[model samples]
Target: MLRQDLAAIVRAGFSAAAAGRLLERALAPGDALPDGALRVIAAGKASSSMAEAARGLLGSRIRGGLVVSPEPRSVPSPFEAIAGGHPMPTTGSEQAGRRALALAASLQADETLVVLLSGGASALMAVPAAGVALDDKRATTDRLLRAGADIHALNTVRKHLSAIKGGWLAASAPCACRAFAISDVVGDDLSVIASGPTVADSSTFSEAADVLRRFGEEAAYPGAVVARLAKGARGDVPETPKPGDPRLVRAASAVIGGRRDAMDGAAREAGTLGYHVVWIDDPVVGEARIAALLHLRGVVARADGVARPTCIVSSGETTVRVIGDGKGGRNQEFALALAAPLASLGGAAAAASAGTDGIDGPTDAAGAVVDQTTVERARAAGLSPDTFLDHNNAYAFYNNAYAFFAALGDLILTGPTDTNVGDLQIILLA
Candidate 1:
């Protein structure tokens, strides 16, 4: 029963249908468009759905389009769909990037270009700047991911290394352009969302270099990448367009969906389930395990204050600094860390943490669920959560625990949710 309720809550929170509706509302009719052809370029996990919404609204106006996603999905005939890579850029991603650039360049000054940007666009539409090999870019991205860099830091570096990111895509187009984004980063900063392909970038090459130095990964970066950043910082290479640049005068962007929308959806579902809802307004950030403990403390406090059943919902992306060679994502680590504290809460508490996109880190599982029985079940199976967590293997821990505690329904699996809004977490006290 607990598992069902939690799943329902998560589903309510990240429904692709709901996201499509929200996108439709954000791009409702009467939004001004230049009196010419409309070309669409959609990229990221939510690209297909966002394109579909755009099609519904501006069907006849959309002349041709392209969408780049981690996997192919059915899209309108006018829009060519290509499968790209995520977490790392692949040859297909390079091809998609080239196609996007060509499409953008094809636009006349009288035409309009609509870019649907969302999470995963950074890798899905990879286009390295001159002199940076794809392999080098991939290696740099891998190092950054392993080093547990936040999205902002990751995009800061990515924008500098890319030919089409950080407003370059917008600059290439002579036509009027607008980008609608489903932000996965904290604060919904346009410059960081999918590297802000159609928006002006305020970050600089020097700042990108600083991010590498701050993360202690500067030495590990590919030599060519380091050289490129250094050159750009020294003004040997042009910087990404900044605010008020003429290249960005015709470009505009709006965030159509994000963490706040997902949180509200979850809150409404919790209330409908007869639980008093407490919304955690602060965005959850930092190391996954530490954030888990902090979130547990908040849950306990809320539980103490309420007489009736209560539900707590919080949203934000968290990082897992990879000290352990374990195979898990931030959401998995978070759920694992919560097990002990939740077990201490006695029998009336259950909690869940999951990525809204349905895939957490490199693992197939979105995240995990835990209750008082989780820790006990692990013991019965001769499993040590600490040992698994120490190895950074939350996926293995949950996989083993799920085998022993099948009734607990600990693994939350929703394949390729096709939308990203960071992550959503819920704690229920009854």
Candidate 2:
């Protein structure tokens, strides 16, 4: 019963149709565009759905556009769709970047460019700056991700090394540009979402360099990236646009969907299921393992004196420092880390952590669900949860742990949710 409630909550929180409705309301008829030809350029997981919402409102006004996504989807419009890489940029990502730039540049003073931005745009629309190779940029991103750098820190450096990010795309166009974003960042800082392709970036090269050094990743970053950042920090290169930059005069950005929306949705679903909803006010961040422990403690605290079933929900993106060369994303690692504590609850509780985007780490599973019985079941199946946690192999552990989780329908799998609002964690106490 708890598993079913969790699944319902996840589904309600990540419904593409619901996301579209929110977008449509936010972009009431003719609000996003003016009386001119519209060229839409959408990027990230929610690109296609967001674009479709625009199409529903502004039919033939969308002359031509492009949508860059991590997977293929049928776009019922004239926009060209391209599959780009995510988590890391690839050659296709470079090509998509060029295409988006070209589309932005093609806009005349009388036309409007509508950019739909989302979580993975930094990678899906990758254009390395001059003298910086794509491989170098890719390597830098990979290293920072493995180092457990947050999105803000990762994009701070990326904004300095890219051609399209940090308001460059907006500066390149001659006409007015408006960006609609579905934020996946903790604070919903427009400049950090998808690296702020159309918004002014307040981060500087010196700060980017500081982030690398602070994270102990400077030595491991690609040589070209390091040199470029150093040169920029020394003021040898121009900085990204700051607040009130003239180049961003005609560009406006607003977030249409975010973590709060997902949280509300989950809360409503839990309430409908007759569970007392306990909203966790703190945003989930920092190390995955630590976040898991903190969340577990919160659940235990909320479980006290509860006469009815209760659901606790929190939302935010967490980081995973790759200590072991294991295969799991932050969500999976978080779930794995909770095994011991959940076991201590003795079947009275269950929790799930998963990326709303339908992918976790590099694995196919979205995330895992664990209860008090999980550790015992694993032990009975000759598996050790501690060993997997040490190896950071949550995906493998969940997949091979006697199929108990699978048989219970605990593994949350929703393919490429077509939207992202960071990660959602749900804990049910009975």
Candidate 3:
């Protein structure tokens, strides 16, 4: 029940009212647009909710806008909403990217362009650089991701390959551009969020090429992508907008919400549920399975002499190497990895790791949870935890265990929170 309550807390923190509250705060320091002509461009997983909040706040002040999201617009929206691809760009993504550039280019000196950015915008808006085909760009991005390159390396490559990313979109506007982002990355890097369309980029073309080479996949990328990077490195093409560029003088941005907010929400719910909340301040990082092992060792030792029931909570994203042909995201893997160690606790304790956005990788479920009995229950159902972990098929294990795992926190399946803030983990112990 605590696990289910944690899911509800995540939903509440996903923020309809909280988004408005944030926008109201974000508007305080910015200069007003006297022309009453506000143009809003929202992109990524939380694009629709953020756009709606902006509309509610700006009202008649907003003259026009665009929303690029992974899902189709539900209709009756004031902005030109396009259903864009995520994790990969589609034709709709290309259309949205082109229109975004045109929209920024059309802005006058007195007008304002508000960019609502979040996670997935990098793929949701992909306008390749000159001479680079979208397919080539897509292929390159896929290779980088599959290589398990970190976000810094990923965005370095992404910014260099695209025309709209890395502050180019903001530079195109003659008017003031302000961005409000729901950060989904650790450390809330402004330049990494949505590839920083409204923030100056410090990455160089040479650095982008280095990322591909560092991952040993430089030659694996499509030819056009490889050629473009080489050209930029050789000074044949211009670099992304750098800091202090005159064009970006009027551009500014802020992180409105993120994983920290979700983390705090979980802590609050735990406290309300009558447990002493203990926070795991360090961000969850590295391979999902390894991280799970470390957490188990640390927390289980700490639970030895607790006088009160406790809720241990932490947040951050972890990566998966994906060596096998299995179906699972990092969160699912994290939770599944805990089953073995958690059984050692020998109490009514449960732990869960889930994406705040409620979608894990390519699967329909958000993530999974495991208790002391999870391993025993799964084995009774004719499953092998080690075998699943070996194949990296955490999702399949959880799915196959569904019949026997009912109400044991098997999944946290909150569909489309319309927000992204990384992932969360909660462990309740007595």
Candidate of highest lDDT: 1
Q: 83, model 3: CA deviation in Å?
A: 0.7
RMSD of 3: 2.2
Q: Compose the digit string of candidate 2's lDDT tens values, residues 315-406.
A: 89888887876885789889878878977875577888989888998977677787778777878888897887777777778787535667
lDDT of candidates 1 onward, in order: 0.87, 0.85, 0.82
Task: Indicate the residue-level lDDT of 96 in model 3.
Answer: 94
TM-scores, all models, native as reference: 0.97, 0.96, 0.94
Ranking by TM-score: 1, 2, 3
TM-score of model 3 relative to the true fold? 0.94
Model 3 spans with C-alpha error above 4 angstroms: 1-21, 28-35, 75-77, 300-306, 406-409
- How many clashing pairs per prediction, in order? 1, 0, 0
Model 1, 1-430: lDDT tens digits are 7777898998899873255776787867666455667999999988888888888888888999998999877889699999889989999999999999999999988899999888999999989999999999999888888888899999999999999999999999988998888889899999899988988888899999998888775778899999999999999999999898998899888888899888989999988998888889889998899999997896678668776688888999999888877886999899889989988876677888999888999999889898877778788899998898888888888776565655667888889987899989998887
Worst 10 residues of 3 by lDDT: 12-21
**TM-score of candidate 1 on Cα atoms, chains taken together:** 0.97
Query: In candidate 1, what residue range of length 10 has the lowest lDDT sum?
Result: 400-409
Error of 2 at 145 (Å): 0.9
